[model samples]
Target: MSEHLFSALRRWPDIEAPNLFAVDASDRLILDEAESQLADIQPGELVIMGDNYGALTLGAAALHGCTGIRVFQDSLVGELALASNAGDLADRYRTHTLDRALLADARLVLLQLPRSLAELDEWAQAIARFAAPDVTVIAGGRIKHMTLAMNEVLVRSFDVVNVGRARQKSRTLTAMGARRSLERPRYPATSVLREPEIPVVELAVSAHGGAFAGATLDIGTRFLLTFLPEMKSDAASAIDLGSGTGVLAASLALARPDLHVVAIDQSTAAVASTRETANANGVGARIDAFREDALTERPTASADLIVCNPPFHSGATVHAAVALRMLADARRVLKPGGELWVVFNTYLGYRDYLNRTVGPTRQAGRNSKFTVAVSVRA
Candidate 1:
C-alpha cells in the first residue's frame, strides 16, 4: 500500500515535468529509516516539515493510522499540492508556520533536509528549543545534496547525531537528545545593502531562513536594478514577481514613493521576509507582500510595471518552466503596454520565451553572467 501510495503521488500546481517528481528517493529513505520510531509515536506527536507534497504526512497516516499530524511546508505550492493529493485524509493534518506551536512537544519529526544550511540551522534550533526533550528528528536528503555540515548543524541542537546507512543514493540523520541550553534562534536575519552597484544608499534586507539570497542582494538582482531608471515612469503600481528579500519591492517603493508595490513569492519565509524588508526600509505602507503560486491569484491586466529576477531553478532542478510560467503570468497581469523587466542567467537564453510569452523583448542590459531584458505587454 505504501509503494502504491508513493507511486500515485503527483507534483500538481507545481511545474510537472518528466524529470521533476513529487516524491524522491530521499522521501522514501526517511520514511524507511523512521519506521521503528513511527511505531513508538502517537498521533499528533508526529511532525513533518518540508514534505514536498503529501508523502511524509500522508505516508505516516496511511502506514501507521496516525492522525492529528502537524505539517509545515515552506512553499505555498507544496501546501496546495498536498491538499490536492490528500483526498479523504485532508482532515487528518493541519498546516502551520515554523514556530513553537508546530514543534512544541513533537516527539518524532520527519524532515526533508533543505539545501540551505541556514534553513537547516533554523529548523534544528526550533526542534531543540520547542520539541520534546527526547524528540528524534529523522532528516534525510539525497547524498549529493547532503553534507557533513548538515549533521554538524543538527549537532548544535542535538547531543547525538546518528548517521543512517545510505540507500538509493539517499541518507538519513537521526538527531536526538535536544540540548537543554539552546539560545533563541535568530531567524529572519537582517542586513544592510551598501554595495556600489545598488543605487539605494542603505537598503535594508531582512530574510527568513528559507528566503533565496537571504538578507543580501544577489548579483542577478543587482544587475536588474541597474535598469530601474528605465522602468515605466508614469506607472502607479508595480510587482516584484518572485520577490526574494523584497529588495526590488522595497527599492521600487523607495525610488517611487508614490508607487504601490506588491511583492510575491511562493515561500512562506519569502513573503514574511519581504514584509520585514519593506518595514525595515520604511516602505511597509507602500509595499504589500503575499504568498502565491506565481501571480495565479492576481487579477488580469492590473499592473503597470513588473520587475523580476526570476528563479531559474525549481526545487533544485534547473528548468525553464518556472521562469516561463512567471513571465506568462506577468503578461496576463500587465495592462496593455505595461513593462516587464527581468534579469536571468545569460546561458538560460530566456529572451525568446519572453518574446513569445510577454511581448516584443529588448535587451536592457547585460554582464558576462546575467542579462536584463524589458518586455512591453502586447
Candidate 2:
C-alpha cells in the first residue's frame, strides 16, 4: 500500500524533473524506518514536516490507515502537491505551519532534515515546546547532506540525540527527551548590510531560518546591483521577481526615487523577509512585498521593467525549468518594449531561453560564475 502511494505521487509544476519519480531513496528510507513504529503511532498523533511532495504523509496514511495526520511544508508547491496527490476532499490531513497547532500532542514526528543548522534548530525547538513530552522525532536526509552539526542543533532542544544506521545512503536522527522551551525563538535573524558606495544607506534584512542566504548579500545579487544604474525607470513601475530579501527592490527604490517597486517571491519566509528589509531601508512606501508563484497572477503588460536573480535550484534538484518559468512570467507582465534584467549562472544556458521567451537579449554584465542579461518583451 505504501509503495503504491509512493509510485502514484507527483511533484507539482512538473518542471524539468520527472513527476513520476518524486519519491527519492531518502524518502523510502524514512518511510521504512517509520513503518516499524506504525503500531505505536496513534492516529492524529503523527506529524510530518518538510515532506518534499507528500511522500511521507501519503505513504504513512495509506500504509497504516492513519487519519487526521498533521503536515507542515514551508513550500506552497509542496502543500498543493499533497492535496492533489491524496485526492484530498475531506480533512484526511490538515495543513499547518510551524506552530503549536501542528505539534500539539504530536507523539511521532517525521521530518526531512533541512540543510541549515538554524532551520533544524527552529524545528527542534518548536517540536520540543509543543509536542508531547515523550515525542520522538525521526529526521532523515541523504547521507551526503547529513552532517554532525545537525545533531548538535537537535541536542540543544532535546535531551538525547541519537544517530540511526545508514541505509541506502540515507540516515535518520532520533531525537527524544524534551527540554525546557526557550523564552524566545531564534529565527528571523536580523542584520544590517550597508551599501559601500552609499555609506549613508543601509538595509536591515531579517531572515527566517528558511530564507535563502539568510539576510546576506549573495554574489549574484551584488553583481546584479551594479547594473541598476543602467536601467531607465521613466515608466516608473518596476518589479523584482524572486526577490529573496527585497535587496534589489530596496536598492532600486533608493536609487530611483521616481520608481514604484514591487518585490515578489514564492517563499512565505522570503515575503516576510523582503517586507522587513523594505521597511527597514526606509522605502516601505515605495516598495511592496508579496508572496506569489512567479508572477502568474500579475496583470498582463503592467510592468515596465523586471529584475530577477532566478534560482537554478528548485526544491533539491538543479534545473532550468524554474528560471524559464520566471522569465516567461516576467515577459507576460511587462509592457510592450518593456525589459527584463535577469542574472543566472553562466553555464545554465539561460540566455538562449530568455531570447526566445522574451525578445532580443543583450549581455549586461558577466563574471566567471554568473551572467546578467537584459531582454525586451516582444
Candidate 3:
C-alpha cells in the first residue's frame, strides 16, 4: 500500500480524543492526526465543532475508541456527509453555528486556518475565551500561507506559540494560555457599480474578514452575471448555489421577480453578505439566504434552475471535492425537468461531470478561461 494510505490509517485513531473541538476539519487531516496522536486514550465521550466537515467525528470512529462523539456543524450536514464515510458511526450530528456553543471544557482544540484574517481573529478570540490555560490549541495550515505574523497573533492571543517543522507543505502552531478579552474589529462595508453592460439595482455589499472579493466584485462573478439566462416566467424556484455576496441571486431576483431565490453558501460571512445584498436591492422578500454546504443540503427536487460559479479551491489547496459536491447536489435538487447552469475554467473538465451526472451537457457560453454549461435533466 502507498505511504499516504498508511499515514491516513495511522492518523485515523487520533480523532477519538475526548472533548475535542476542531474548527474547520477541511479534509480531516487534523482530525485524523488528533486520533493518531491520542490512540491510547481510554474510552470517553467526545464533542467536535466544525463548519460543515465532520472529519473529526469520523476519525474518532476509525480509531474505534470514543465512547461517543457529537458533532456541531453548520446547516450543510447533508453535504458534509456526502464526502464523509462516517454514515453509521456511533455519533450524533447537529447543524448549528459554532459560536452558539461554549468550549470551556474542551481539552484540545484544532483550528484549520481560514482564508480571512478577520475570521482568524474571531476564532482566536473565541479560543482564548473558552480554552483553559493548559488546554492545547493547535492551528495548522500550508507553510506558504502560514506566516510569522499569523503565528504572532496566536502567540499574542494565547500564552505561548510554537511552530512545528513543515510536513507535506503544512505546518502546525501549538499554543497554550488563557486568552484576554479584546474588542472585536468591526469590518467596513462597500458598494461598487456593476460593469456598464449589466443592469444595476440596489447593490451594497459588506464583507466580513474572510470573504473572497470582500472589497470588490470578482471578475468571474462579473462574467457569470453577463452570461445569466433570461428567466422564463415558469421559473418558479431558483438557487444560487454559491451565492457569494448574493450578487448572482440579487441579479436573478431583479430579473425574475416571480422566481423565489434561495442563495446558499458555506461561510457565515457569505450568507450575511447575500442577505445584505438582497435587502439593499429591496428584493429581500424574494430572496432567502442561508449558510449551507452547497454540496450537501440542496432542496431535493426543489429548484427549477440552479446557477453556480463554483470555487475551485478552499484556502490554498486545489481541492475539487467542493465543486464535485456542488454538481452532485445540483443534480439531486433540480426537478426532473430542471436545468443546471455553471461557469468554470475551460480546462477544469466540468463537462465530464455534468455529462455523467446531469446528462447531455453542452456549452451554453464560453470565454478565454471559462466555459458555461447548461445541463437539462433527462
lDDT winner: 1
lDDT of 2 by residue, 270-367 (tens): 88788888888888999988777788878999999999999887776667786887777766799998989988889887888888888889999898
Q: Which candidate is the best by TM-score?
A: 1
What lDDT does candidate 3 reach at residue 168? 66
lDDT value, residue 117 of candidate 3: 66
lDDT of 1 by residue, 203-224 (tens): 8889888999998888898888
**Clash numbers, per candidate:** 0, 0, 9
Model 1 RMSD, rounded to 1 decimal:
1.1
Ranking by TM-score: 1, 2, 3
lDDT of 2 at 218: 86
lDDT of each: 0.89, 0.83, 0.63
Per-residue lDDT of 332 in model 3: 77
In candidate 1, how many Å is residue 41 off?
1.5
Clashes of 1: 0
